[model samples]
Target: MSYEEILLETEEKMEKAATVFSDELKGIRTGRATPGLIENIRADYYGSPTPLKQMASISVPEPRMLVVKPFDVSVIKSIEKAILKSDLGMTPNSDGKILRLQVPALSEERRKQIVNQVKDLAEKAKISIRNIRRDSNRQADQLEKKSEISEDDCKSLKDEIQELTKKFEDKVNEYFDKKQKEILEK
Candidate 1:
């Protein structure tokens, strides 16, 4: 592949890694309620597992409360069961048509734990970005070996890839810091 193609592919992959990390952070509970936390919860709908976002409407009626109203009333039980099955550690209070989830205050220890989890996720994203850089470097080296690119051009391409890796790794760190602050907030 050409140098430009290799660089572009590397950047796109790194961007995707950062985005995935951000989305995952949204699912990690904080001191408040948010639709993102439970929207991805899978429930049995007609014997098939389906995401809660597809089966219900989730609203944060209060700072610490989420109201879930299923379009199909019959799925209320399934939704409740899904919440119970999730790692969220909260039970859904259901009344036929709607379910209410109360997001409890995070203890100091829990907040620390969540922060640690965020750190782990951020590290994983950085690892993914670095892997992309490695692959792009390899492609550049191959091009140099084949004489498709001059030695200087290959070295320049590797430098560009390294810069992209640093940029994306910084973005991941930014997201992690933001999420850690959110989780630790009182």
Candidate 2:
């Protein structure tokens, strides 16, 4: 509606892009076990697809192992089946009630592939942030044309939006670098 509103919207979207990138990076496999990898998986629960976190309690008893204890023992088989079918590539060792997944070490090639994927994701986030900046700048121009905002106000708003974009882009780059290090660590 106004230049200030446009800037706020742009800032909000930039932050959202950063948050999304961070969440996705958590799912990338590394050298250790973490709840983020499988917590969002959709497992068949009585003909309905449910998030694994809701169906089971996941814990990392060791650095390389994940113990998944289902709230309903009857769902253990379903959970196992889901994990087997998923791209996690880890075998599920089920013992009637609880399931264990042994997270394996990533090969050098796999680590490189994952790093490339992270780079791609980071690029996409940056592009999205840039697009938001463009749209906000365009809106500011429109407000100036309509005399709702002075040219000086529009210029200031665009500058603020650009700063927000740079801040979020840096955040995305920071996430990429951190994840890359985690994936490559021995």
Candidate 3:
């Protein structure tokens, strides 16, 4: 493949890594209610397992409260159980129909802990982007060795790939910083 193709592919892969990191950070809750926080919960409905989002309609009735109304009222117990079992550290209140989750404000220590988790996720995303750059650089070298591109071309491609890596790494850091602010904010 041409160097341009290689660089484009590298960028796409890095973007994917960043998107995955952002998605993971969504599961880490702040002091407010967002559907993403609880939708990921896998509820045991009868003998089948399903995501809460698929089993019910989740809404934010208040800034701190989330209402989960199941399509089938029979699954209420299981949905409540699944949420209680999740690591969100919140309890679900059900009135035999809809389950309400009250999201309490996080303690200072808990916010710090969540920030640390975001840091870890950002680090992993950087590592993935670097790995992609490394693989792309290796491919560039292979092309040069096969006489498909000149030695000078390979050097330029390597430099370009490093630039792309730095760009994506910065994007990951930006995401972490934004999330941290959200978590630490009241």
Q: Which candidate achieves the best TM-score against the true structure?
A: 1
Q: Which residue ranges in model 1 land beyond 4 Å of their true spot?
A: none
Q: Estimated TM-score per prediction?
A: 0.99, 0.97, 0.95
- Prediction 3 global C-alpha lDDT: 0.93
Estimate, for each residue in 88-164, the C-alpha lDDT of model 1 and write its tens digit: 99989988999999999999999999999899999999999988988889999999999999999999999999999
By summed lDDT, the worst window of 10 consecutive residues in model 1 runs over 87-96
Clashing pairs in 1: none
lDDT of each: 0.94, 0.92, 0.93
Candidate 3: regions farther than 4 A off:
none
Point to the candidate with the largest lDDT.
1
Q: Model 2 off-target regions past 4 Å?
A: none
Model 1 local distance difference test score: 0.94
In the range 77-142, model 2's lDDT, one tens digit per residue, is 899988888899999998998999999999999999989999999999999999989988888899
lDDT of candidate 1 at residue 95, scale 0 to 100: 84
Using TM-score as the measure, name the better of candidate 1 and candidate 2: 1
lDDT of 1 at 1: 90
The CA lDDT at 8 in model 3 is 91
